[model samples]
Target: MRWFFYFAYICTMETKTSKIFGLRSVIEAINSGETISKVFLQKDLTGAISNELNGLIAQHNISRSYVPIEKLNKLSKNNNHQGVVAEISPIEFADLDAIISTSVEKDKAPLFLLLDGVSDVRNFGAIIRTAECAGVDAIVISKHGSAPVNADAIKTSAGAAFKIPICKVDHIKDALFQFQAAEIQTVAATEKTDNLIYTIDLKIPTAIIMGSEERGVNPSVLKMVNAKAKLPLLGEIESLNVSVACGAFLYEATRQRL
Candidate 1:
């Protein structure tokens, strides 16, 4: 098999993430510096090796949960899972500082896409695909309250997740500060702004921010950005889907940069 992923233990949704079963395999993965998102362990598991795994998981600050053995059995297809399985992120995240450093060395201006609380994996993936297609230099997402770079996100991205550099920031506001320091203008996509997207100068280095599905950009975030712009809404619909709006924003930048 090339690859397969599942989330049998989740009660909220049937979203799938790449997984590797067995305790020793997980330990080896951690030792080899694999991007492990979370680890599921059988309840009441103990002993030296399990203890070692626990220590390693803690040391790396990886999220973990203790579930029933039956849950582990389902996750592992009844195979010997050694009471543990780990979720692995398919794409390795890039460093924001590194991206900024190298982007300045290039001849062309850098284009970055930042997601503010976009939690839907499908939406996140679609935005990623659009950013990659628009020649975005990098994508920045907050570490918490964001969609996982799991199987579904990668699938929805049509493999663009691997092609583009996705950087995880401790907070979206923190990233805005860094972009400002680099002299990259930050633009937020929101309806609150009176300025239209067409008026903004995107020919220079810029980072575009897209907000969550439920709400537009955070009020605090909007305050930090250098400029705020919105796409023209000709219809009665008050808002557009975050992904669709993101495509429009990125392409406008593309057109201006061209």
Candidate 2:
């Protein structure tokens, strides 16, 4: 009788454990476009649930990991996690046109940061922190080449991601055209320019374009810029990292405004 009870208890525990392990809850979160920090899946678990989870992660650009079942178990604190867990956040995005209109209506100079092909989430977050500190009105990024505004990005921004306006656009060129029409001077930070950043008057309505570390600004964006300026390189390095360059440019603008 005692032996039978022990066997039944073991079966019940195992059943409860399996019920809680894996994809159902995680898939629901992804489908909602929730800010998923990370997703973990049991290694070698190939099933309907895993397939659906993988498809959703890929479609939404959510980061994921295939880990041992024990890892998932540990994460869930022995809850029936079924073999998957996802960390998420409550981050929000700002509307692009609304930000632009609000900045202009306030009679502010509308100091803006335009990021071209900057894929690194850390860099994106750091730039946002600096831009907020320097009183930039908004930070614009292209939809295709930019990093997703995930939990890591929000944390890296020191909460500035929530405080500052971020504009995600379909085509950077179209956004540039709108800025130009609004009488906002668009300046590209490029090594190709002979003019230095300090020489340009940022006190006026300005949009500063900072490009990617690998490719610099897209050629079309470079051509559309009202002016192209470079930070004078006194050091041996050819150029500053994108985030550092963004800070320098922003502070220079701040100084001019002051």
Candidate 3:
């Protein structure tokens, strides 16, 4: 049974992954209008191929990484990567402005989720799934610190990630400001808050910021949020899993809105 579980995990990790290896193949995939999430290049790569890849990256504004050969090999599963690999995103990212505007146009308040340092793929996926079910307007995540929205994440979300808009920004702080600029109040979920989530009025345009389990929330981000909230705990456990807490917060907002 353990072996079967191991095999299933391996198959899940490898199967249905849209990865293009080798420089030529990656370039071709990009040229074909595929939505490549990011390209990984071997560190110390040089010559015409490297230059060509760089040119294409700049031309298409593609995200890239300079990694060791071992890393590339792992990504390629020991296949012939030829010093390059590109991950294709299963779904398109959403535009934050458009999401807010559409929500307002439909006479619905915008409710978004902003994740701070939530790098666990499974947790991220679960939060996305719950948010979609809760009818969140969109989800915002930092491009650098957030988990990769890969096959596992998509599967864990049960295809909800594709149905919802995922707005990736360079930083969560800036994204929070963008929400405020659009008249959406930013709320942070942290233990520092004595205010219960249900007590806070979530019927208005709102963006809820959830931090990683390791770190409750970035101090700077906590300071910037319009309100801070915490879930009530009856048990001895001091905290809830980030995904679970997020679902609770989102549903509270949903209940308020409805």
Candidate 4:
């Protein structure tokens, strides 16, 4: 089944391909290190095959949507979609450790961006775009409570997601400890503090934490941070959007680094 899928994929001229028809074929694509952007499951799907597909999607952190059979059929162009379709990517993820090691080896202060519970794909993509523009060493995100790196995110990032190193951690606090142990100061961006972003000296090795829109930073992660700062707001609005805040923080760091 996998061979058939691969043969079909090889014969196609399309730069990107979507898998359809069988459950195992989609699973094989994921297991074989194929870049799955998204997966669509028929709304009424159940039984062994459905269970297995669900498990694989969770394991690989693949974004999925429950849709009607008609939707899947439409997506598969009236082909034998078999209640599933998976979108493949044209690029791959970067090595997290290599990004950090290279930054230190070059005598560069490690400028890292940590996103805590940011679920919006557009926001995540926008942040990556800014991080790449500001020359961030890497972006760290928790395995859960973050946006999946799907095709929409990649497109919105203008391919910066492929260019940037994105580290997925199980526990954000543990990752913060690792960065601190490596001599990187962990900075959290919050409206709770009075310290202006410009006042913080980002010339040193730094890791900036940007939180979610509704909840802000998780308190457990907040406790692990070395310092907390805020972007001064003169307008009636209290805070900035997460992505905009991230860009402001990163570019401020860029200024100090220069």
Candidate 5:
């Protein structure tokens, strides 16, 4: 039997289901600058506290979903959720611009990892650990549809999640354009091309883009990159785990640099 490896992340640092229950409590967490991955609100829930929570969500540009009370119940373990629950991120996200600017000032050609839509916490954690070990400068992820950075991911990363600067963006294209603007090249990891990563020059300032576990890079995103390459597969097995592929890509860059 052939086993394909497809492994992977989300936009924020939700080190797990570390959550805050109660409407007023969630509001407080937001005001306190706690990194919140998301807030689940009871559908049609209306009150002074609800208004405050909505305002906070808007002010902070947080992602909120009006879920059924049952969903909240499951998330809160029947705790006094008060119609609201907020998933708290253990680590704060860094600004992509700041990381780019700082990297430009550095001596090493700055290597970055951009996840298109990787969705597994275990994969995400492994990727983070490998990225840090391979000297990756930062990792970027989209704000929606990606997996949450739960405790499993944190444990898998061996706390590398705390060590790395992760950036959350509204769209993958935003980060892609930013890198291009800075004259940094983007190389998408995909099997859609005849190009092999071995031929690509990893010594330059580069951002390597890995796609979702289900699909490779999005067709739209692939059109926007400087290049697309893939690792070789000699056997019948078609793919590598997302984390394993990420590690391979990262280490390849490391190998070339060394």
Candidate 6:
């Protein structure tokens, strides 16, 4: 099944970047270790080239989508895309296991941010920027319902997306389980909680789950976290934007750690 990526234009951190289009160019980029965010291939494009692309995707764990030819045309800006176009990412994604190990090696507690369903590109970017500034160890998000790491996200992040590890997992729940087994606490930031964010002992290794502004944290995820916390919102505005709320939550953890 071809997946269409309908994201707005996003500029790159560097002025000079190789524009990769067509199957051969994309295959070369993948083989040469280029940081590709995702690949868009025309739906039902099957042949030796597609087979080779699938093989490389399996070998490198690259993100891919199958979509209509029109979608591919739009992505390639009407260039001769040959049924494939690869978006190159400036920053290489970090492995979750390696991130955890590095923190352990340094004898430091890990602080990770997990987004439940933050699909807004700007919001995702802001969270990434703030997480980097707050010294977060990594930012994790499920691949299914999260925003694509496009140019707008990168630009909105002020390039902080390049500074931190953004780990895309198969499932948020499974990742939470790994953190628990590793003795890391997972905290959900939501208004439904009476417990204050300041009261949590965030100095320990922790992962903070921040959800969309509209829905807050998922109930299932809330139940699984070690603690539920909220910032006292004593104003006419019912809530803060997810990005603002995330920044607040992360900084409180920073305060506790310091």
The regions of model 5 sitting more than 4 angstroms off are 1-17, 43-48
Q: Relative to the true structure, how large is the alpha-carbon lDDT of every model?
A: 0.88, 0.80, 0.87, 0.82, 0.88, 0.84
- Candidate 5 lands at a TM-score of 0.87
lDDT of 2 by residue, 1-258 (tens): 976865665455334422123478888877776656567788887888788888988887655678898888887888888778876643555677787788888866888889998889889889988999999988887756676675556656766787887876766787798789888999999998799998999999999999998989888889999999989888788888899998999999999999
**TM-score for predicted model 2 compared with the true structure:** 0.70
Stretches of candidate 1 off by over 4 Å are 1-17, 21-28, 38-58, 61-85
Candidate maximizing TM-score: 5
Range of the 10 consecutive residues with the lowest summed lDDT in candidate 2: 13-22
Residue-level lDDT tens digits of model 5 in 21-94: 99778888888888888788899999887998899998888877899999999999999999998877778889
The global Cα lDDT (0 to 1) of model 6 is 0.84
Clashing residue pairs for model 5: 5-240, 5-241, 6-241, 6-242, 7-241, 7-242, 8-124, 9-118, 15-150, 16-151
Flag the better candidate by TM-score, 1 or 3: 3
Task: Estimate TM-scores for all models.
Answer: 0.78, 0.70, 0.85, 0.78, 0.87, 0.79
lDDT of 4: 0.82
The digit string of per-residue lDDT tens for model 3 on 91-175 reads: 8887877777787777678788999989898999899899999998889887666777788788788778888999877789989
RMSD, every candidate, angstroms: 6.2, 11.9, 4.5, 7.1, 6.3, 6.9
Instruction: List clashing residue pairs in candidate 3.
Output: none
- Candidate 3 stretches with Cα past 4 Å from truth are 1-14, 55-62
- Per-residue accuracy of model 6 over 1-258 as CA lDDT, tens digit each: 112221222333434343579888899989998877778888888899889998998787766778899988887889999999888866667788777777756667889999998989899999999999999999998765677777768878877887899987877897898889788999998888789999999999999999876787889888899999999989899889999999999999888878
